[model samples]
Target: MYKYDEIDQTLVDERVAQFRGQVTRRLSGALSEDEFKPLRLQNGLYLQLHAYMLRVAVPYGVLSSRQLRGLSQIACKYDRGRGHFTTRQNIQFNWIKLEEAADALADLAKVQMHAIQTSGNTIRNTTTDQFAGAAHDEIEDPRLWCEIIRQWSTFHPEFSFLPRKFKIAVTGSPNDRAAVRVHDIGLRMHKNAAGEVGFEVIVGGGLGRTPFIGKTIRDFLPKQDLLSYLEAILRVYNEFGRRDNLYKARIKILVHEIGIETMREKVEAEWLTSRDGALKLPQAAIDQIAAHFAPPAFEALPGGIAREYAEAFRTDFEFGLWARRNTAKHKQPGYSIVTVSLKKEGAAPGDASAEQMAAVADIADRYSFGEVRVTHEQNLVLPHVRQADLPAVYAALKAYDLATPNVGLVSDIIACPGLDYCALANARSIPVAQQIALRFRNWERAHDIGELKIKISGCINACGHHHVGHIGILGVDKNGEEFYQLTLGGSADENAALGDILGPALNATDAVDAIDTLVETYLRIRQAGERFLDTYRRTGLAPFKEAVYAAA
Candidate 1:
């Protein structure tokens, strides 16, 4: 994790003080709601259905034990005793009082965290793979560059008020855990044929009322030119992106209208002037940022098949199942990256109670070098757990109801706050997700079903990333009635694709049964060892769609 220096600390403290004054003014009636809207948004405060919600950024999904404790304290003191982790690698406190928003910001500042840029039409949080530094197949640590972008884009005067919100994601691994293809700006780090490292810069990728997979503007951009090139892209978008209609204001709309070739030409022309300017990174600065992400002090252990681990796997069936589902191979031998699932059956996805947060912090400190990671899939990762200690870590997590062993199964759903908390939502999302989870509560059945992603969003905004799920559920309001539109064959991995709508929208009650029918159809038709996605891809939507709409 990057520690804040004097400059960083000063900036955050100043922002906190400014927001505190603004909040006080609003509460004292010196500022009206209309006047305070932008001010509060800039500080990551949103007026929701029943209360104010405060969203705190967890940059690139990394958290230290101290920061986790700070979030727990906020959950305990300012709002309800729970926090909701979001798809953007941020956390939200749903019940925050309007008057205490400033106090919450001040508390966050004490831990080198802030709510700045978490919302608004500015550049939001820059996210990366949960297993950034520890993935076995990573070409480089993408967070090194994500942090660089975070520092550059935070409160940048040029981009502070874009026509619409912009998002960026970086991925060092070819597996695409960060879902780079669906971001406003997606950077994939890779080595060329000559073995020189750089980025494949993809632009125009977004999901909302309209969904589009980003196009590669630059096939290969030199590592040192990242900042200048990024600036060029932003400059182009800021100048030409639509400002007339809220629906057509995103950079993706601009790219769609102008075409990728023209967009690239403009960006390249802009870059020629700024490539060697002040934004060009120096070798020393790169080294400084990279130093912050160096590998932990790992001990030498046997490379393959530790005796104790093997014995435990042989003896404990449940632990073995969890190990297979929740753990991934680390770059270092004898170590693993363990995902702590927050999606316990029938619980809200990506939410943790204050006590659970504290317990996770304690476990991280004792077992994983005092570090934890939030995943884009709404899970947490202990990045450096020793293989021999898997049993103890599993037991500790089980004690807190965090060990669900359903990392990629059907029940490990990703859902947004929807109508439950979001004002923009047209229908409820959490209840829909809860029903689906409860339907698939059997762990053995869920694991057998295999690698199904069910994402739900209360509206077309796609905050739940429903557009990319294997089974995407989008909530819609039809004449004041709640209905859900289902889509199939979407994926967020390397083979990123948008799902196709199966049929007409179904009533909320029928939606769960529709999912059941689709699953049953898959199970009956799947070939040996084929996952849900693989079966859907091979068999197409006809079979599943027919089953889902047959009774309707």
Candidate 2:
């Protein structure tokens, strides 16, 4: 909810104009595809399987109703009549034309949105907890710092171009909703002993061809030094991160090669020279940016909201399960975080049709103070909904085919648009994801299955974040055919750990059964009421792994 200032608008406008000119030159053949590739990529434009895909950044995943409506317009006007919300809290239009890319960007700028940091080797969209200002356990609103970081990193002259892409995730809550531990630079905010707010900074975490849980370089950095500390880290990465080998060029590899001790020392030395310089965070500036995230003037609702919500749930078992999963604890007494599931039985994961988009807008207008968020989980969030309104919201959403009620269940699959759509994909992911969802369509059965994060990716690029799922399914090529590989025991919590491969790959037809075997084995062996992840940790993947590969 960081309001744009004149400076912010001007910067966005300039970037759009610059990219527009670049697109013009590229289309005119003055700049060849080879030459224009990097430039266009820097602006978040990519030529996909069918057409150009334009990724539009939704900073910190926050979107006003107006902005969401704008995105709906872009999808209808420039590309397909729909858009794909990505795990990074942004949306990708998969059918944009090369010539229409600039116009798409221009339209985005009109709504205080752009694809500025949606790609390229720079600090990408600063994601935070989807329930940033509303989460009960949060120390402070993290989006304030995210917005500050966005401003600092936008076209930062010294760090604009780097050996590899840089990603930063911030979390104010103890819960790791943004998967901070799996980012290039992760910031966790907490109150220090002296009642001062500071960050526990981690570096080197990322998910792709090589997944790494970033190591903590500094346990606690004072808030005022946020920008300086980040600048120093980027400087060390820019100078020492691998450049010769693209495969090993990520900061994680650099951290791994140099050792955490050496990386920490280097970052500290860089910080010693850079802290309090131009990048140092000022109290006034921080306060000014922080002001935009001030909590909405929430009216006092009746305390019976919880009772009313439960009554509806009691009457509806499916709605009851959804309330338990999709809704999160809100900071206020009666408010709740409502996740609008895009994964209906047959729709592609993370997709919102033009009509569904407008439905979300309408829901936001009626219940959520005209604000919504695109979570890294690829679901729309009404973060500050009143508990009393849960039934009505659920009803409205159900009418729009947005009410899946399988938030943390196995059917809530995360997948990238793979071979069927993306040019870079090696295999199909969406169909596989759909198959899994269909396999779990029995709400009662899915509800019994319990909490699990199933992430899928078409190829190693990991656009779908397959590396972080409790049950990770990665699509790969086998003799010009598709094969699905499974990984179990991954998590993105405070104790964030990447999942491990469970063994050999399975053909597309065999995958759903394989997953069912794993889940059934988990249910059989797991302690009473234990979650899938918890059971996996306590008993190890041996049980599920053995069962999955047993008679195959």
Candidate 3:
């Protein structure tokens, strides 16, 4: 994790003081609610259905143990003992008091964290894969680049307020775990014919009322010109992106209106002006940023399976299941990336209690270089855990109720805080996700129906990223009743594709059953070694649609 320098510390402290004064002014009648709206939003506060929600930015989803403890403290004092990890690799605290907003930010700044640029119509957090430094298949660590972007874009005068909220994601692995294709700007790092690593820039990919898989604007952009090219793209979008209507203000809509070719032409023309200017990154500057993310000190353990890990897998069935589901390959010979699943049966998809957060922080400090990571799938990660420590880590997590063996399964749902919390939501999302997760409690059955992603959105905003789930459930209001529309065959991997609707809307109970029906249909007809997504792509929507509706 990059430690905050003097400039970063000063800026955060000043922002905290400024927001504290603004809150005081609002309380003293010097500022009206309308007047305080933008100010509060710029600081990551939102007026939700019941209370104020403050979103704290976790840049590139990396956190220090000290920062996690700080967040846990804030959650205990201000929020109702819990925080919700979001799809964008940030955390949100509901039930915040308007009077304590600035106080919470001040506490965050003490730990070198803040909420700036978390909610405004500006460039939000730049996210990347949870297993960035640890992943075995990475082309390079993307967090260094993400940190560079973070420094450049935070409080940037040019893009402070774009036409709408913009998101950017980066991935260094061939397998797209970060869902880069669904962001405003997606950068995939790869080596070209010359064997020099650069970015494959994709633009206009977003999920909202209008979902789009971004188009590749540049096949290969040199590392030195990343910022200049990004500036050029944002310049094009800022000049021409729709502002009259909120629905069409995103860059995705702009790209859809004019083809990718024209968009590329404009960006290239704009880049020609700034590519050689101050935005061009010098090699020394790149190294300075890269040094912050250099690999953690790793011991030279034997380059094979640890005896204790293998013995635990053979002896403890539950531990084995959790290890198989919740861990990923690490680049270091003896290390593994452990994902602490927050999607326990009947719990909100991403809610972690203050106690749980503190416990994970302690665990991370003991086993994983005192660093923690948040995933886009709403989970916590210990990115550098040694395989020898697997048993102890599992035991500690199991004590805290964090050892749920359900990653990438049906029970591992990604859902938005629907009507229960959000003022914009039309239907309930938490209850539906809870019910569906409980339906798949049988481990044997869940493992058999492997690698299924079920995402739900309260409305069309796609906060839960329902557009890219293997089975996407969208909540809609129909004549004063809650209903869900299902979509099948969607994926957010390297082969990104939007799901096709399976049928008409169904009530909550029937929607849950419809998911089961769809799963059963896949189980019956799937070929050898085919996952749900592969079967769907091969069979298309006809079978899943017919099965779901027929059951209904």
Candidate 4:
């Protein structure tokens, strides 16, 4: 919802031009792969297993209908008729010509989009809760702050080339839908006793080969000093942070090695000097950004227990399932946030077909006032849908294969495009994810199984957030065949915790069965009303592991 001003447009144009030159140099052999790898990576171009993959950033997963339509065009023209939305709230064209990346970036700029900072060891996309503005219990729309951070960090002079990439997540919701606690910098909005709004800043959380839950650096930071405070923290990391080894280079490592208390001391020392500097935010600027996210003049919709709504659920079992899964609480009394799950049966997760994209845009236009959000969970959000029109919306989505009701269920998996598309990947991820989804196709079974986040990344980079999945699966290639190693009890939520590995790797073909075994075993063993994570936390891995491996 943040509109690009002339300055923003100029920045995009200039970056595109810069990348054009860089790409030209690479193509002309003036810049070898050694020189061009970082340059191309910075521009969001990667040479994968088969072809070039171009990742375009959709900041905080927000997109206009026009932008979505443009992406559909890009998918149809440059890619294989679909673009894969990433866990970082970005879209990737798995098949792209190396020569056309600059042109592709230009096309993106036309719609006020770009791929800058999507990759490389700089700050990546700042993600927020999908239902930011429309969520019922938000302190404020977090995307406003996300946009402010975007402007402040974009191509920053000092922090541009860091030891490792950084990620920041914010959520206005108290429930922590954005998984802020697992980010490099996690910001949760809250109000003090005096009713003045502020942020709870947490730092050092990340998921990779090493995963950590961020520790609270500040109990409460006034909204006005957000940028300056953030600057102080970044300055501490930039100046004193480790850079000797890439693996030990993130701020999380710094926080762990230096100890949270010492790190806090260093950050406070820096903040004392930088608090009133130019980075200190202006009240007018914050208000200006907030204006863009103003809620629509939503008239009170009929909240009665309408027979039509009830009948739709009662008669159509599929509609019932979808409504149960795809809808979230809305700020307005009778409105709901309708999540359009991109992960349907047997297809790629987060990869929406052109037709599906258009249909979603149509739904946004007709029912939700032409605003749709691409969520980090690889789904689309019609942020404000009337409770009465749920049936009609469900009917419309049913036609496009977007009506899958497996949100937060086993089938709603997050997976990266692996060896199938990515050269860096050691094992194929999409097919394995599809197999797991197909295996758990039974609606009753998945619902009974309850919430599970199964993320699969092909390699150790953890692009799919495999480190954070309730049942994290990491694919590895042993010799020529693929195998998967599983990690359990991981969660990305209000109680964020990285999973621990259960045991040895499973054969590639047996991976889905392995996942199915784990879920079924949990169902049989869990206490009443306990979810997968809760059971894992309570009972530990021995029972599930015994049940799973005992059969073998």
Best by lDDT: 3
Q: Give the TM-score of candidate 4.
A: 0.97
Give the alpha carbon lDDT tens digit for every residue of 1-552 in model 1: 899999999999999999989988998999999999999999999999999999999999999999999999999999889999999989999999988888999999999999999889999999999999999999999988999999999999999999999999999999999999999999999999999999999999989999999999999999999999999999999999999999999999999999999999999999999999999899999999999999999989779967767888999998888899999999999999999999998899999999999999999999999999998888899999999899999999999999988999999999999998899999899998899999999888898899999999999999999999999999999999989999999998878999989999998899999999999999999999999999999999999988887866
* lDDT value, residue 89 of candidate 4: 82
Error of 3 at 304 (Å): 1.3
In the range 317-366, model 2's lDDT, one tens digit per residue, is 87887788789888787888999998987789999988889889999999
The superposed Cα distance between candidate 1 and the true structure at residue 2, in angstroms, equals: 0.4
Error of 1 at 142 (Å): 0.8
Error of 4 at 337 (Å): 0.8
Off by over 4 Å in 3: none
Better of 3 and 4 by TM-score: 3
Please tell me which model should have the higher TM-score, number 1 or number 4. Answer: 1
Total backbone collisions for each predicted model? 0, 1, 0, 1
Residue 516, candidate 1: alpha-carbon lDDT: 93
- CA lDDT, candidate 3, residue 192: 98
Ten-residue stretch with the least lDDT total in model 3: 543-552
Ranking by TM-score: 3, 1, 2, 4
- Clash number for candidate 2: 1
Prediction 3 global C-alpha lDDT: 0.95
- Runs off by more than 4 Å, candidate 4: none
